[model samples]
Target: MNVYSPNLELARMVLDSQPFSMYLGARLTAFGDGGATLELDIRDELRQQNGFVHGGVLSYAADNALTFAAGTVVGPAVLTAGYSIDYLRPARGEVLRAHAQVVRPGRTRVVCRCDLFTVDSEGNQTLCAVAQGTIAVAETALPEPVE
Candidate 1:
């Protein structure tokens, strides 16, 4: 069976419209062909007591990136079913980049892997975290428009 797919434009629109995306100050930097990249600045608010990016923030960004990557292959109806995250190093930098790629695209599910990197002012990137997520298509009934 053929699966649904969403182009970069539609993926960006859908991601930007999400409330959590606004809350996290997440931006869809790039999206295309079963892949997606998101960027987030490590402002004071997003840092922990040690002046490093918070773990939760990295996880959130990674999750969103993976979801968007899966959406590129599975379309807008897809929803994240589960995710596993691993923090390799502290994210201490000015910005964080989350890059995701679809590992497997199936009829009903899409599996994605993401790498979160901390980029310094000098453009040095350090691998901070890695995540794997599974997204599955969801079916929902839409209400008819009222006249």
Candidate 2:
């Protein structure tokens, strides 16, 4: 599906401004009405003691991607209510990709599904985790930032 270009720009700007995403080296690759793709480079610091990417890292990516996907129709004011994920395999790859899509959309809440994959340097993708999340959309305008 073609991405809504404005939402894509907003997603990129949000990711770029997020301290956590910045520290994790996450990048917003694409975003549209109900979908978002986030990518992260695997680094030593992001791995568990066993050398696989950590679960927390995977969850973080999924959560943000979920929110971004919901944000496409909900605007920028959205927060995740909760999410659950199951890890299918240990992530061992050069990069991690979190692909999220809103499967159920509403005025106040949106449900999103995400698949976390590890992409090897050779570009092979292995499913590492799956997630489902509920996002709450703000029905009212958010307060402006104070100077």
Candidate 3:
């Protein structure tokens, strides 16, 4: 499959068009052919009762990064079919990053793996979560009345 990097304009468009992504404040940090990195600042809203970044927040970031990376290979019309995540450590930092790489690209499905890390004020990296997802290419356009 041909690989092409998405420009910042395209990345912003993708991020703005996605409703759930907007809700999570996901920002596209970098994008390449079959890879992408998303970032989110850990705020009080993202924390769980323990005062650490919630696992669900990490999962959402990872999943978003994986899906965006896969979309760079396939088109932007892909949707997540299945996803699984593993939490390794708690996130105790002020910022978080999710880096995703495309594992397998197919006509119907694209598989991606994402690694979520927390970056401390000292610029140290801590492995927080790992996620794998399969995105299916949309067969048809969404519901819209045609003229």
Candidate 4:
């Protein structure tokens, strides 16, 4: 199955603009047609005390994936209004992946759902969490990028 979006380059640029996303090494691997996928390699720093991937990391992926999915339909100037995530399992793998799609698209707001997964070395993916979010069109433009 083809997962890449035609707008991958533009979406990746937007993802790279976020300091936190860059810090986590997250990549916008796919985006467009009201869907998006974010991926991050698992690292020692992203683990919890028990050795599983941190919940916050998963939440971050979900939130960003949801917003990106919304962006495919609502355009670039958008913000995540709010979101809720349910952790389904402990994530222990080589990489973390979040796939999201717009549940509903609107002029002023968009609803999205995301599924978080952990991919093992052998390419097995385990569902770790699920999320739903509401994205709103930004009333003001985003600030200029820092030089």
On TM-score, the candidate that comes out on top is 4
After superposing candidate 4, which stretches have Cα over 4 Å from the reference?
1-6
Q: How well does candidate 4 match the true structure in TM-score terms?
A: 0.93
User: Between candidates 1 and 2, which one is better according to lDDT?
Assistant: 2
How much does candidate 1 score in TM-score? Answer: 0.88
Global local distance difference test of model 4: 0.91
lDDT-better candidate, 2 vs 4: 4
Worst 10 residues of 2 by lDDT: 1-10
Q: Cα lDDT for residue 145, model 1? A: 25
Model 2 TM-score, 2 decimals:
0.91
Per-residue lDDT tens digits for candidate 3, residues 97-122, read: 99999999998999999999999989
lDDT by residue for model 1 (28-108), tens: 888878899999878998889988899989989988898889777766676789999999988998889999999998877
lDDT of 4 by residue, 1-147 (tens): 323334778888888888999999999888888899999999999999999999999999999999999888767778999999999989999999999999998777899999999999999999999999999988777776684
CA error at residue 125 for candidate 1, angstroms: 1.2
Going through the candidates in the order shown, the clash numbers are: 0, 0, 0, 0
Best by lDDT: 4
User: What clash count does candidate 3 reach?
Assistant: 0
- Full ranking by lDDT: 4, 2, 3, 1
How do the predictions measure up, each by TM-score?
0.88, 0.91, 0.88, 0.93
**Pairs in clash, predicted candidate 3:** none
Ranking by TM-score: 4, 2, 3, 1
Off by over 4 Å in 1: 1-5, 140-147
